[model samples]
Each structure stands twice: as structure tokens, then as C-alpha cells.
Target: MTLKKPDPSTLDLSDVDWQVSTFESGGGGNCIRFGRKGEWILISDSHNPDGPPLVFTKKELEAAILGAKDGQFDHLAGLG
Candidate 1:
């Protein structure tokens, strides 16, 4: 069965439980924070907890995680 992507716009982000990766703690650097609401995954900068976030479907988030594990997005780090 195909899963429908949930609309982040319809979500109440305030009610979601946001979490930071364990690697982010005491790393002396800012990193991304993520939260999940149903099938949607929301991402935001840890430094800006109140800032706007980018939302993605669970499948899309999974794909991104896999890509990161494989170093497929290593080049992005240099773009900063």
C-alpha cells in the first residue's frame, strides 16, 4: 500500500516531541534537530529551536538517512 505524505502545514509542531541526535550533544557545534509527527519528519536547526522547519515524509527521511550513511551527501558539508 502506498502511504500518503502528511502535510506538515497541518501539524501542530508545538505538540511534537523534538529531539537532537546524540552526536549533537556537547559536540561544540550546531546541528540539525528532528521531530516526528505521525508519518512526517520535521527538521530544524538546533541553534534555532524556534525557527521554521522542513518537513518530509517518513520514506523520504529514511532515504536521506541511508544516503548519509553511504556518504552520498558528504559534498554538502563543503558548501558551507
Candidate 2:
């Protein structure tokens, strides 16, 4: 099957509110995902663009986001 590319518009990824993130396929270290519903996402806060992006199940990600909204989860991200 052909892999479907993510549409930026549909994802609504952007730098604002310091919450909700989506992973970018680039960077070396310091990758973290943070934020709330409607503002959900993943991202890599690094340089070099070598490290692989982290992965999270839709359910797990949604759970984490809920945890974040309630101030329960930390923002340290990693690949799964």
C-alpha cells in the first residue's frame, strides 16, 4: 500500500500555546510532545535531523494529551 503523507493543514501543527505537538522527521535530540485537545501534536526539538521521530498510538496519544491537560504527564518525548 502507498504510504499517505500527512497534510499540515489537516494536522494543524504550529508553534503556539506551548502545547500540543506533532513529530517532525528531522532533528538529533530533545524531542518532546506537549499540549491539550484540539491542540494535539508531536515534535522534535533538536538539530542534525538524524534521530527518528517518536511514535504513539492514537489512543495512547490521546490519553497522554488528556494527562497533560490535567497536569499529569511530563513532556520528555522518545521513539517507541
Candidate 3:
């Protein structure tokens, strides 16, 4: 079932249990961390732990995961 996308303005993430990806914890560069707030996923850069996060719905997150697995975003590495 598809869920409605939430309004980004209404989110309050003051108590999120943020976690790092296993790969990132193992000394991976370009590290990313994520947390959950209801059905939305919150992503942030590990290098800037206190920075603002990018929010994504579960569906959007799944699409991003698949795209990454398929190397659709490999070119992003060169942009750094």
C-alpha cells in the first residue's frame, strides 16, 4: 500500500535514534547516516553530524537504494 508523502515542514526530529550504515562505520568515506521518524527516513552526512537532514518517504528511499545498487549514482563520486 502506498502512503501519503508527509509535509516536510511538520516534522520534529529532536529525539531520533540516528545510526550509521555498517559500511560507513567501517571507515568508508562519503559516509552517510540515517534515522527514522515515522515512515520517513532522515539522512545526514556523517562528517557533519549536526547538520540538517534530507527526508525521504519509504518508497522514495527504496527507489534510491535500488538506484545505488545499480550504480545509477556512481557519477556522484566524481562530483566530490
Candidate 4:
């Protein structure tokens, strides 16, 4: 089944239940927040909650999470 992408401009972010990762405790304001609304997964900077969030489909978010777990993006963080 194919999921339709949501229009970010039409999304009301106020309704999203944003959450920070537990592993980010005491990270000194450096972290990302994630939330979900309908069929979209939302990601935004924790330091700027009022800023626009990046939206993704379930599968897309899953792939990103898997990649992170595999350290595919470690280079971007200077870890690889």
C-alpha cells in the first residue's frame, strides 16, 4: 500500500506531540525532536520548536532510523 505524502504547509504543528530522545538527557540543548501526525513523521530541532519541521513517510523514517543504527550517517557527526 502506498501512503500519500502530507502537505507540510497544511499541517498544524501545535497538535503534534513532540518528544525528545531519552538518550539526549543533559545534551545541552543539542538534539532533535520527533513527532507524528496522521501518516506523517515530523522531525524538528529541539532548540527551535517553533521552526518548521521536516516531514517524512513511515517507511522513509524507518529507513533513516535503520541507517542511523548502522552508523551510515556517522560521518556527518564526525564519528566515522
TM-score of each: 0.71, 0.36, 0.67, 0.82
Q: Any residue pairs clashing in model 3, and if so which?
A: none
Ranking by TM-score: 4, 1, 3, 2
Model 1 clash pairs are none
Worst 10 residues of 2 by lDDT: 48-57
Q: Going through the candidates in order, what is the number of backbone clashes in each?
A: 0, 8, 0, 0
TM-score of 4: 0.82
Model 3 poorest ten-residue lDDT run: 21-30
Candidate 2 regions with alpha-carbon error over 4 angstroms: 1-45, 74-80
Task: Judge candidate 1 against the unseen true structure and give its global Cα lDDT, from 0 to 1.
Answer: 0.79
**Which model is ahead, 3 or 4, in terms of lDDT?**
4
Candidates' C-alpha lDDT: 0.79, 0.44, 0.78, 0.86
lDDT of 4 by residue, 1-80 (tens): 77677767788887889988878546686689899998889998898887888889888999999999999999997899
Runs in model 1 deviating more than 4 A are: 1-10, 24-29, 78-80
Clashes of 4: 0
Considering TM-score, which of the candidate structures 1 and 4 is the better prediction for this target? 4
Q: What's the residue-level lDDT of 42 in candidate 3?
A: 89
Which 10-residue window in model 4 sums to the lowest lDDT? 21-30
**Residue-level lDDT tens digits of model 2 in 1-80:** 43344443445334334332355545443445343324234343344223333333456677866987776645344421
Candidate with better TM-score, 1 vs 2: 1
Give the C-alpha miss distance for residue 53 in model 2, angstroms: 1.6
* lDDT (10s digit) by residue, model 1, range 16-46: 8888777745566578888987767899888
Candidate 3 local lDDT, 14-43, one digit each (tens): 888988766644464557878999878989
